[model samples]
Target: MFTKILIANRGEIAVRVMRTARRMGIATVAVYSDADAHAMHVALADEAAHIGPAPAAESYLDGERIIAAAKATGAEAIHPGYGFLSENPDFAEAVEKAGLVFIGPSPRSIRALGLKDSAKQIMEKAGVPVVPGYHGDAQALVVLATKAREIGYPVLIKARAGGGGRGMRRVDHPDEFADALAAARREARTAFGDDRVIVEKLIEKPRHIEVQVFGDRHGNVVHLFERDCSAQRRHQKVIEEAPAPGMTAAMRMAMTQAAVKAAQAIGYHGAGTVEFIVDAAKGLKPDRFWFMEMNTRLQVEHPVTEMVTGIDLVEWQIRVAAGEALPLSQNEIGLSGHAVEARIYAEDPACDFLPATGTLHHLRFPQPIPGVTLRVETGVRQGDIISAHYDPMIAKLVVHARDRKAALSALASVLEETEIAGVAVNTAFLARLVQNSDFVAGKLNTRLIPRHQQALTSFPEPETRTMATAALAASGAKFAPDAPDPFDAISAYAHFHPITHRRAIRHGDRTRYYAITGLGDGRFAVRSEEENAETLVLPAEYGERIVPWPGHLTIFDGPDNHTFQLHDPLEQAGLAASGSESLRAPMPGLVKLVRVAPGDKVKKGQPLLVLEAMKMEHTVCAPHDGVIAETVAEGARVNDGTVLVRFAESNTPNAGRPARRNIEPSRL
Candidate 1:
């Protein structure tokens, strides 16, 4: 066994690996980039080393620098967690050449399954059924287009070297194939530096099911059952559950057998997940599932597998890397209760689930609750920044219970209790999704989110009590960001006798007025327009009912975290505001392409430029028919709210455009 090891990753996965290492009495080393200097993963390591700058290419993805850090720290081996260099065969080979153990599959095994086309061929040779697709080496346009036609309409063009939904596209008709293929290649080239692609038949009502398999150097392999990742948005998984809700005995037997066969075929070791696409249009059967691809390392949703199987996957990875045999036979491994995991992200669902980035000024998660095994796997603290330099994931919230119903119920409650500020979050969206009728009943698929987007994406208004709480906060009863407590003297602001005040708060599109009266002794009477006066006591330091900062305050509500603006009277009377028009960046990103320039005439919704951030691309479009005055140069790094394109001085045409408010920095 290794006395100490180095983790070649960042964020939650790194922190997760360190936890297992510490528990096993093994020291761990962590590597960080300039952006992650104060990150949670770096602080949790027994030793740390600096890699390079903020860009992943110069830091996390720099395999040589990572190996050097491992050697300098005297780590016996290196664990490539989930992303970064986890599945890179060249990096694995280099680590072996450096006289250190690479705590994962051998380079040969990685190469066998690194590309989707080759992996399909290998799986077919091993008798593991693969999805029907064009796995050819042809890269010409006519060749791919002909293949798509032969496979029929509604085909999927996927980047051979991509994952996490990047460099993938769906074409519904023959006319759409060319554009989709071009887009997929562009994304693939940017993300993986490989533009090769494969065309596959798009399955209807597809339920994504993956089996967790482990192998050892002794050629012993076992299965850890399966997880259903059907609930998704934009081809990215949103919610996952283990022991697929409607799985049958016969199907489970067949899937597990095939998974073990695939791993054994490649002589795989350590952790691996064999993903499959099931045709749920009918139902799960022995022959309905087809192998999609194999992930050569751990997945982001590994916690759900651990919850149901009562196993430590990270520990298993470490032990297997040390040449230990399989811990248990296939028959000894059994599934217990159900487990569900929801990815908590800093994103806004209303705007098509765009990822958000900012400092986490105030963050709160749930504690260990009763009757549920809760695991909050995260690498971010309250003050850490969810920067654009990396993924915007905050944590993975996992819960296990006796059944799927109980598990879903518990997960809903936990999401409601989660409080976050300074960034948009998908907490409300997740809370609603768990209680969704189809989701609760397990009628799941990749289209679940997109089909029910209206109900899931619309943010609801605050309740009466929540508004009353906000009113109390704005009254400055406990703490205030403006003047000191007026109740202390009651001279000028309080009118010397009946201390009364009125506040106007602006929400989405409307403003509400509240009448407040100071009742003394940390109490206030607050009344809205339609509701009667309600007296509520303020907890010490105002509690978490409301979070007040410089210019705004956050109120926790059921449907959303309602942050209201208490506008200053002087500022409102200044002017109607200059309405100069310009297209600004929604978040910090790199300008990938620029299609418009000064004096260029563009139509509404015309793609003017593309901004890439967090591995997702969002196109900045013209708001209305107008002539562009100036545009930001291509290849320039920009921050949130930076003007990317400006309209001519007298050519401001915002027809059919909604009023612009404060732009929240978010993901693509």
Candidate 2:
């Protein structure tokens, strides 16, 4: 094994690699950008080096800078952890040329499996069944459209050089093909700098199952079962599980054999994943599965494979890069138990899962239950800022149990006990998914989330008790150890036996007045006009944060976090300013495209601009039919709520009158 290695990545993956390297007595170096100067991975490494600015192109993607840092730190190898430069063939070749071992597949192997079109063709030749699609080199639109028509409707246009669901679109009809293709090409160019795309037949009710394979320099390879990653949103995997729920012995054997063959055909070494699309409608049969593509590095969902097989993939990667033989043969490798992993992201499920950025003022995870196995992989700490310059994934929650039912149940409870504040998260959504009947029964597919949209997307309204608790916290109620009861300190005054405090709390689109009365001792009576009165003891705080500006208080209850703003009488009495009527950027991102100019008329819901954030494209639309009075130019980096377009009210009775416009950006 190498004595020291450098991790050429950031976030949880970097931390994950370091953990294994340290356990194996290998010192690790970390490279960071300006934005990640104080990142968790940097703090964990034996040594750290600054590469460049925050943008990936300037730092993480700068192969020269990374090589220099590795050489300066005397690192014998470099591990590209799953993103950024992980799958880049040129970067792999560069590392080897710099006299440093690249802890992954050979550059030649990467090139053979890097592009989707090329990889598909290679798989077909290897006798690994591939999805039927046009893998030709023609780049003309007409040619691609004709191919799509011949393949039938509902074709998927995927970027030849894409991963993580970027640069992909599904066309349902011939008329929609042109628009979808144009959008796919644009996104592909922006994401991968390649505008080439391949058209494929869209499988219905497809379950995504992938086999984990490993290889060594001695030309030996083996497979590690499979993982079912069917639970998804926006074409990205949300939850993944190992030892696919309904997988049969015959099916598993065939898939694993094919996966091993795929790896050997490319002379693949180190860790890689061969992803397959299974037609659930026909069950997991050997002939019913087709190769989608291969991930040429360690996967984000590798933890589940580790839990089931008792294997450390990172350790294998290092040993193989050092020219070691395969750790175990295919016959000796076996799965022990079921494991499930849920990706907890800083995103809002209600708003099309748009990525959210903010400070993690408070972060907490569930305490481990005895006899139950649970693991959390994260690279963030309390008070760490989740920046918009990187992926929004905050952590990965993995749980293992004797059976699928037990694992599913444990995962739901774990999610319920997890607490986070200062930003939107998908904890509640994840909890709902684990507890969902269909999901529990293993009736899963890529469309699971969309099929249960209403149940999974709706955010529950804050309960009356939750609002009352927030009101109490906001009203200067703190946990006092000297007083036996929580209300003892506040109710000490005999003259104020039944003090009543009224506060207005807003949740979602509704605001309700809460009347909380202290009943001495440790009890309090809380009531809302919309609900019945309930008397109870003060709830203990799991997490809390107080902001002085608008007197906002946030409290955690189960899986839900509630924020209440203290109503100001002065603001209600004309001290506060009116709202604005302009289009604002929903999140911090780069303005990729501006579709309208000043004074141009646009209809309601018309696309006005596209903002690229967290590696996803979000289109901003006009709120109403109006003329653009002012607008920002393309290629501008903007913060959240930065006004991008100001509108002039259209065809109103006061059309000639000047309207109050607040186009200036406001600091939060």
Candidate 2 lDDT by residue in tens digits, 1-668: 79999999999999999999999999999999999999999999999999999988899999999999999999999999998999999999999999999999999988889899999988999999999889889979999999999999889999999588888888999999997888888788877888899999999889999999998989888899899999987678899999898999899988988998999888888999999999899677888999999999999999999999999999999999998898898788888989999999997777657677888877888888666799999999888888888888899999988889989889998998887777778898899899889999899899998899778878666665567776666565543546765444554454736556666765543556766666555555556656555654564342343332235666655556566667766754441233334666666778878899988999877878777777777777765688888887899998787777777653432222111121111100
- The parts of candidate 1 lying over 4 Å away from their true place are 463-465, 478-485, 488-497, 500-504, 509-515, 519-544, 566-577, 600-603, 649-668
Model 1 per-residue lDDT tens digits across residues 101-150: 99899999888898899999999999999998898999999999999999
For model 1, which pairs clash?
Answer: 355-666, 355-667
- Where model 2 places Cα greater than 4 Å from the true spot, the runs are 478-489, 492-502, 509-517, 525-551, 567-576, 598-603, 624-627, 650-668
Best model number under TM-score = 1
lDDT for 257 (candidate 2): 87
Candidate 1 to truth, TM: 0.92
lDDT of each model, Cα atoms only?
0.84, 0.82
